[model samples]
Target: MSRTSHITRTTGETGVDVQVGLDGSERTVEVATGVGFFDHMLHQLGKHGGFDLRINVKGDLHIDSHHTMEDTAIALGQAFAEALGDRRGVVRFADASVPLDEVLARSVVDLSGRPYMVHDEPVELAPMIGTDYPTSMTRHILESFAYHARICLHVSVLRAANPGQKPDAHHVVEAQFKSLARALKYATRIEGEDIPSTKGVL
Candidate 1:
């Protein structure tokens, strides 16, 4: 089956459109919100999620990344929710553990139509490959994704003993995205036409 979705949103704050293909070849992301770091993070999300994602954001980024980032998450979440249709025989639950060298990260997701996030702090992680802004933006992105998509998400990083180890923010953030990708990949898979739950809805 062809699994794809297109979504559009416009408000006084922003104008956004996104197209995503779940069962497509690799990924191609085009995001220019003028937030350089946020763009990189979204690109990583698309690449590792194995989804062909194209996002266009026309927003007042001169203000900040808030509008761009939150709207992007909302659009993408709407796309996924639309593409999934009725939840239908999908796994609905998925988890992944990813390690970027010493920085290990884990993400767990449930397509349960309940929005929630549980994160473990420090909340401080060295960037995996980009600037600090996107690193901080990750938390907000995850929160928006879960809320708009009506999913439950939990993320945590185990405190490793190597306090002196050079913490690479880029690597840590990349690991987080990779973990999310794997978790989402499994969660969105289509198995049959059942509701994935005892109740006939998600």
Candidate 2:
């Protein structure tokens, strides 16, 4: 099975095209979503997930980050769905435990056609340190991605993990990507496994 996919989408809000190869050794990330921080996060996602990604996007950022972020999720999710056609013979469930100094965050995923997200952490993030607005943007991005991609996601941060230590926002956000990468790695694995569904098709 070749883990390569190419997808293009042009919506009223955004236009995007992306190519991803899951089994590739060399990764190249090209993203132009008018959001530098978001682009960096996506690049981290690609690099850590062991996938090659190439992306081009044009969106109406003059209004807000909504269109760019949402459309990016939609495009990327569609690509992932197209790539994993039928979802056969693959590990369909995965979880990861990631820590960023004081923040011990975790994520779990189920590649099911049910879209859901459980953000079990407080929405308090330091200002001007990272993506400007981590709580809203990251949550929105992950939720939109899950819904569009038809996957289940759960993200949680351990309370009192490390108080009084203001961890870098970049590190905090990067931990999330690393967790995503680890979960995706397990979820996309071919384990000689069944379809992991009772409908006989997925």
Among these predictions, the greatest lDDT belongs to 1
1-202 per-residue lDDT for model 2 (tens digits): 7877888889888888888777655667677777888888888778777778888898887777778878788878877777777788879899988876666677899988778888765545655334434446677788877787688899776532466755565666667867887788788777875788997766
lDDT score for candidate 1 against the true structure: 0.78
Per-residue alpha-carbon lDDT of candidate 1 for residues 1-202, written as tens digits (9 for 90 to 100): 6678999999888999998888656557677766677777778777777888888889876676678878888998888888777677788999999887777889999999878988753444553334326466678888888888889999887642257775566666667778888899888888777888877789
Off by over 4 Å in 2: 127-134, 159-161, 165-168
**lDDT of model 2, residue 70:** 82
lDDT at residue 155 of model 2 (Cα atoms): 75
- Give the TM-scores of the predictions, in the order they appear: 0.88, 0.88
The pairs that clash in candidate 1 are 89-194, 126-168, 126-169, 127-169, 127-170, 128-169, 128-170, 128-171, 129-170
Q: Which ten residues in a row have the lowest lDDT in candidate 2?
A: 126-135
- TM accuracy, model 1: 0.88
Counted clashes in each candidate structure: 9, 0
